[model samples]
Target: MAVNAHAASARTATARQPRLRIMVLGLRGVIDVQGGIETHARRLYPLLARLGCDVEIVQRSAYYPRERRRRGWRRITLTYLWSPRTRIAETAVHTLLGVLYAAVKRPDVLHLHAIGPALLAPLARLFGLRVVVTHHCADYEREKWGPLAKAVLRAGERLGIAFAHWPIVVSPVLKETVETRYGIDATLIPNGAPMATPRRTRHTLRRFDLQPWRYVLCVARLVPEKRQHDLIAAFQAARPPGWKLVFVGEIEQGDGYCQELIAQAARDATIVLAGYQSGVALHELYTHAGLFVLPSAVEGHPIALLEAAVYEVPLLASAIPANLALPLPRNRYFPVGDAKALARQLEVMTQGTAATTAERRALHAAIRANYSWRKAAELTSSVYRNVARGGWQHG
Candidate 1:
C-alpha cells in the first residue's frame, strides 16, 4: 500500500472506533531499554497513541527512571509498579503485580509481550480481563536460561496461546510453530527498524577512536545466544587488516559472558567493547561501519539486522530461520555459530564491495517498503478493537 492509502485507512478506522484503554505487561521499560521487546514497544506505543488508543504500559520499578516512571511517554501512561529485580523473579513478579493492577482497574484489553509475561495469561483470563499476547520470541531457546527456566518459558508460550483472547506472533516462523503445536492461527506482525538519518558527521567515530569504514560492528546484548565469541574468533582468524572488531551493546550485572569479552578486549587492542549507545551515536556506528554481523544462534526477528539494512551496511548473519526470513544474497549467510565458515565469508566480503550506491538505495527502499512500524501499529489497533469487542472466537 502507498503512504496515502495507509493514512486514509487509519483515519477511517480510528474515526469511528471507540478509544481503546490498553494496559501492557512484559519488559523493564521502553525509555532507552536495550532489549528487542523494549525496542518493539518504544516504536509501537507512540503510533498507537496517534491512532487514539489510551495506552498505559506497566513498568518494573527497578529499571525505569524514577522521576519519569509515572510521568508517561508520548501520550501513553506508564505506571511504575514495585518489582524485585532479581534475575529469576523479575518478570514473573512484575507481571503478577501488573495483572493484579489490571484486574483492579480493568482496561479494554491487557496486552502481554513475550512468553515470560504471557505465563500469567490464564490468571488474567480468570479475572475476566481480555488478554492479548505478542509472542516476540521463544525465550526457551536463549542460551542463558537453565532447564527449569526453559521448561517454564515453554509452558508459558503454551498457556498464552491457549488462553489469550488473541495471540500475535512476530515472525512467520513463530506463527507456523504455534499453529502446528497449538492448532491456532496467530496474527503475524514482523518487527521494524527506523529509517537512518543521513550521516554527515564523524563525531561518534572520533569519540570511539574509530575510523570510518575500518570497523566490523555487531550491536546486540552480550548474551551467550548472541554468539559474540564466534564472531570474535572469526575476526581473529580472518584478521582483516586495518579493520577493528567492535561490539556495541550492554549486559547485566556481573555477566560472565561480558567478563570474558572484557578480558579478550584487554589482550587484543583491535577488539573494542563500546558498551550501549542510543540516538545519534548508534546511528553513526551503523552508518559508518565497514560491515555488520549477526552471529546469533536464534532470533524471532532481529531489529539489529533491520537497522543495518536500513543503514545500507553489508550484512552477514547466521543461517538461522529468523535471520533468513529477510531476503539476502546466499553469500551473506554462514552456518550458525561456525567461526571457520564466518572467517572464510568475512575474507570474501571484506576484500570486496560492501555495497554499491544502487544496491544501498535498493535495500533502503525495500526495507522502508516491507517492514513498517506504522503498519504494525495500525494492525495492532484493529486487533485491539476486535478483542475488546469480543470479535474473534479464540481458544
Candidate 2:
C-alpha cells in the first residue's frame, strides 16, 4: 500500500498540475493564538498556496468574530463557520458545518487537522471529496476529557484511521502506535519551526521585570497534561535565587485547573503568568529566556520545543518518549512528573554556565535540517496529488 501510494505521488509530481483545491477543517482559527493545530495550519497552508494549491481553512466563528475576521491569510482563504462556545461541542459542531461547507464547495481534497474533526471522514468521502487526516495526538489521553469524551475521541481516531485516504502522523512515536494498534502504515510528517530568530527587545521583558537569561520559559496552553503545576512545584522546591519562572499561555474558560495554577503562581512574586502572546512579544520571550522547559506529560510533536531548538536556548524537559525523541543530550532529561528530579535539574541549570557557542550552532543546524516547513509542505502536496489521482480511494 505504501509503495503504491509513493508511486502515485511520484507520477502526480511529474505531471503538469492544476490548482489543487483543498478545504481544511479542525482548527479553532488561525493567525492569532499558538495552539499546535492552529500554528501548523497557519505555517503549512501558506507554503501550500505557494506550491500552487488553492487552500481554504474553516475557522470557528465563535473564536474568530465575523466583524473582525479577514478574508484570508497569505494565499489561503478563511471561511468562518458557527459552533457552540463550549469545549466539548466546539470542534465537533464546527467540523460538521465545515464538512457540509466542503460538500457545497466540492473541493478536490478535504484536509482534517485533528482526530475530533476527522470523525466526519466518512461523510466527507461520501461527498466525493478525498480525505487526509493529520493525527496530532491521542486526545483521549488528555486529563481534561471525561469518560464520554474519551470514548468519542477514541472512536474518532478509529474512524479517521479507517476512513481517511491518507493519514499523517506527526511523530515517530505516533506512527509506531498507529501501526502497532491499527495495522495502518500512516505517513510520517513531523512539525516544523522557523529558523529566523526574533529581534531581541527589552520592551516585553521590561513589562514583566525580567532580565535576559535570568528566567525559565514554558509556552503551552494552561492545561492539565502540560504539568505547569509540577513545574511550579519544582521551581519552588529549587528556590533558584535571582531567577524567575514564566508561563506564556492562556487558560480556557471555566478550566478549574487554570485557577489552581493561578493560585499557585500567586504564592511567589518570581512566578509570572504572562498569558497568551504571539508575534514579536512571543518571539522576544523565546529569544531572551535563559532556559526553555517543556514539562508536558503528553505531546504529538511539540512546536514549542522545536522553536526552542531553533533559538538554541538551553532545554530541560521531561523524559517522555516523545520529548526524548528529539536530538538533545541525555543530561537534559528528567523523569516525568518527578518534581524533585526536576528541581535538582533546575538548580543545576540556573547555577551552571550556558551552552557553548559551538553547541548552540550545532543544535540550530540539526533542528533546521530535521524539521523544515518546506519539506513538510512538499511531502504533504505529494500526498494531496496522490489522493487526487484516486490512489487510496475505496481501496
lDDT of each: 0.88, 0.86
Off by over 4 Å in 1: 1-8, 65-70
Model 1 accuracy (lDDT, Cα):
0.88
Best by TM-score: 1
Tens-place lDDT digits, model 1, residues 111-176: 999999999999999999999999988889999999999999999999999999888899989999
**Count of backbone collisions within predicted model 1:** 0
TM-score for candidate 1: 0.96
TM-score of each: 0.96, 0.95
lDDT agreement of model 2 with the native: 0.86
**What's the CA error at residue 174 for candidate 1, in Å?**
0.3
RMSD of each: 2.4, 2.3
